[model samples]
Target: MTRPHGRFQQAFAKALFSSTEALDPAMRELATQPAFAVYRNTVMKACIDALEANFPAVARLVGSEWFRAAAALYVSAEAPRDGRLLHYGSGFAEFLRGFEPAAELIYLPGVARLDTLWLEAHAAQDASAADAAWVARRTPEQLAALSLRPHPAARWAWFDDQPVFSIWERNRAQGEVTDELAWQGEGALLTRPYDTVTWQGLTQASCVFLDACAGGATLQQAAERALAVDVKADLAAIFAGLLSAGAFTAPSSSPASNERTP
Candidate 1:
């Protein structure tokens, strides 16, 4: 039932994915076998390299050989849809979740997700850091109604059941993975303030607070939400920390758009 072009495409795709597979019969006479093999190898290498670049922590957790094998399978199963390799591995975290061989590492998917967030933050559109002095100028009433604008390059808290942020930090420092520490749920906020992507771990209350702010809630509402998360939450410290980190842009009349203050 296959049309002529469709049949040729299916065979060509098969040949493209594997060097050992013969070229489509129609094209076999058009190109040399050696040339096809070289092309296949080059394509596979590029895909593996892209995976490695995006998930260096995953590669470090599993040795290069294991990572390479997994990458190969991933590339074959989930080839890039577009020419942009920068966005190539968006589904890799999900891929890792179903990857049977990685079943032992319950944290791998979280790590991959964090890695993707880091990439996104690094590539996000540039925005000026919010001026902390603006807070001093606002009346208490104005402040209550004022919603904080999040930096374009800032990503709100990402919570995971695994201690993904701790693992990522330790791995980045090239520290030894130890069994001595107890792992628990952790959260991360990724931001690119200057040239480097930075992240900080957050508690459940803090994560709730930031998520609320990112959704366009006023500061008072964000604090109320945080208190709902934990009655003893310290709103002042969280506000100060976010301000110091430049997680937010200038205060705006509307949360959806940034407005410059005099």
Candidate 2:
């Protein structure tokens, strides 16, 4: 069912990252030309550059030489599907998890994941964040029955075995790591309530609460889930902090219908 031009396009794309011998007999001469070599190199460099920009924390963890080298391998295996390089490297974090060179640095994958989340938040659709005052206007009974939608720009994750948020935050900010940095599990929350993307470290309980909310749980149900995760969690403080951080959208009569899972 493939058209001739479509087949040629696919072959040409593959040829860019492969040897000229892989090209069809009709196009083999073109692939060996000097201009073809230059074009191929340019495409490869662009992909590597996109990965470097997209996964800055990973690049910072590894030196430029190492990062680019690994990125080159990734580029060969998975090229961008479109012209939007900002959305490239969506699978970089997962790739790093199975990458042999990164085996010793287990936290690197988590840091890469956080970096991807940052990009997702930055590129997410615009929406007004719900303020604490919105919750204040509701009665206790009304609040219990109301479901909260996560803002379209909100992204969060919990790294169970690594203090990924701490490491990623310091690296992303280009801050120096100190000896006092603890090696423990950590979570991260990234949100763009307004024009700029903002992030902060979170506890596992907070991540659980957000997950519950994203699944269309009511505020009271989300809080209960957070408590189930950590009996010592301060529900009032967590709820207030999340509200202040613009994590949720304004409550509506049909919150579940408008829900956008983070």
lDDT (0 to 1) per candidate:
0.78, 0.88
Q: Per-residue alpha-carbon lDDT of model 1 for 173-215, expressed as tens digits? A: 5776676545678878888866788888777778888788889
| Best prediction by lDDT | 2
TM-score of each: 0.83, 0.92
lDDT of 2 by residue, 152-229 (tens): 999999998788998888889997667676888998999998899999888889999999999989888998999998
Model 2 misses residue 55 by how many Å? 1.0
Q: Pairs clashing in candidate 2?
A: none
Worst 10 residues of 1 by lDDT: 253-262
Q: What is the lDDT of candidate 2?
A: 0.88
Worst 10 residues of 2 by lDDT: 253-262
